[model samples]
Target: GYILFGPADSLTLFSGLLVLMLAPEFFQPLRLLAQHYHDRAAALGAAAELLDRLEDLPDKAVQKHENVRNADPGAGIVLDQVSAGFKPGQPVFSELFLTLESGSVTALTGPSGGGKSTLLHLLAGFLKPDQGEVRIFGLAPGEVRFGWLGQQPFLVHGTWADNLRLTTPDASDVAIETALRQLGLGGLIDERPEGINSPVSESGAGLSGGQGRRLSLARILVANYDLILMDEPTAGLDPDSEVYVIEALHKLAVQGKTLVFSTHQPALLTLADHILSVSGRGQVLDTSRGGGHYE
Candidate 1:
């Protein structure tokens, strides 16, 4: 008979091997927990800071503005002691006052980056004055019928007719052709076989700078709003194109469309019924012929 190995000795050997296998596995979770403790603490701290910042913000007050008057096509625009800026203490304008009559062309002349566009924004109600009032048609900007053209024309990847159709989708071919011709696009239309249906790249890439701008003007022309606001409508146009644009503007003024445009061009300035020279100190000096008024 073979000598029996002790049961106790076998038990001890098996137990030792089991403990060796489980020791690293048991400590792995503990090591991971230790490593992530700092991450959790950092997350908690960030959340606390966000909550504190949210709590520090002041509550906004909401009030309903009533429009008591109906739309008046001949109503004038008035800015009473208006001030505006992107930031406090670094205002674009301060306590500015002026009045613009309907069916007249008012040119705002100033150095570039001197709140000319800001003034347009204020008039369009795209921005709010920090202090003062902008009354258009005896109502707020939101309550008026107006159109705006920025320094750059906004175009899309479509035909010339398609862009114009944005303002009047139901416009006929004759109407579209007439609007284009008014903006001196007759040459441009004839150059392309597609005419008004000619393809226009996004942002008017295929068209010249002047063509794009005139196209932009064509949209407003078709809309025929009571008030038209333009910012540097002749910024990149050649001498010929500039003349055409000025003539078109004069025609609009004759049509009794209240027009306000900002420009640095001498020719554009001459067309204004009144010229308001905006100074850095928020002073509006009327420098038109026979106009010595200041506000």
Candidate 2:
């Protein structure tokens, strides 16, 4: 016997709980699928909406490609003894110094809830470090413009092209076309009813997780930035798309673009010229892949 308590809404909440609690003898596979497949399902919804947005945006000039380097295309990033934590009272990782230079892809891998994302957030200027300094191309985080793609692909509703053009409103048709072709999306563009102007629902509804991730990656590819920061770039992608995106990342690195992405898979990590693994407590794992070659 359960004692009923709280306001009118409480009983409804309790009833919902009863539905879950009463289903103990239900099929295990269904329950497992619901739990395990949630992220995958959500990824699909996100991907579809992203495609729609890509089709909707107006044509504009692709951002001008400016070659930059630490001395001058891709410069190295430097974090001098930086520390970060959720609150002022307590900090997780501290005194971390790392250099992820241009012409290489660095994977930020670590245990679950480790400060890898937090470290990225610090480097991206989304979160100010509590200590030390973060510099890009010898400029502070705020000075330089970089692109950021997170675990969940985020998009503005409307059309697919609109989302693509957001980073570069002035992108010419040729530039956009080239970008699409580079990512094997040229045919996709043609298949869509609106071409690049295809409509996307909010937060990428119709596309699969892989499609959304690729679309977001495509947007990042089009941006002219010194550093590209991606969190869990391959988390929700299909095998083919993940491989495509990973290879594309390598190509960008070869082209002298600095990339720092977080990954949980060793396969996806192999392309990384460098690997920086962070611990659950914010300590970075050593023995990172060496041979920093851009060519």
Best by lDDT: 1
Task: List candidate 2 stretches off by more than 4 Å.
Answer: 1-75, 289-295
Residue range 66-172, candidate 1, lDDT tens digits:
34237665668888998898777888878777788888899988877777788888999988999899999888886676878887888988999999888778888
Worst-scoring 10-residue span by lDDT in model 2 = 60-69
- Where model 1 places Cα greater than 4 Å from the true spot, the runs are 1-69, 292-295
- Checking candidate 1 for backbone clashes, the offending pairs are none
* Model 1 residue 82 CA deviation in Å: 1.2
Worst 10 residues of 1 by lDDT: 60-69
lDDT of each: 0.83, 0.74
Best by TM-score: 1
Question: Can you write out model 2's per-residue Cα lDDT over 145-184, one digit (the tens) per residue?
Answer: 6888888877789777677788888776677667766766
Candidate 2, residue 90: lDDT: 71
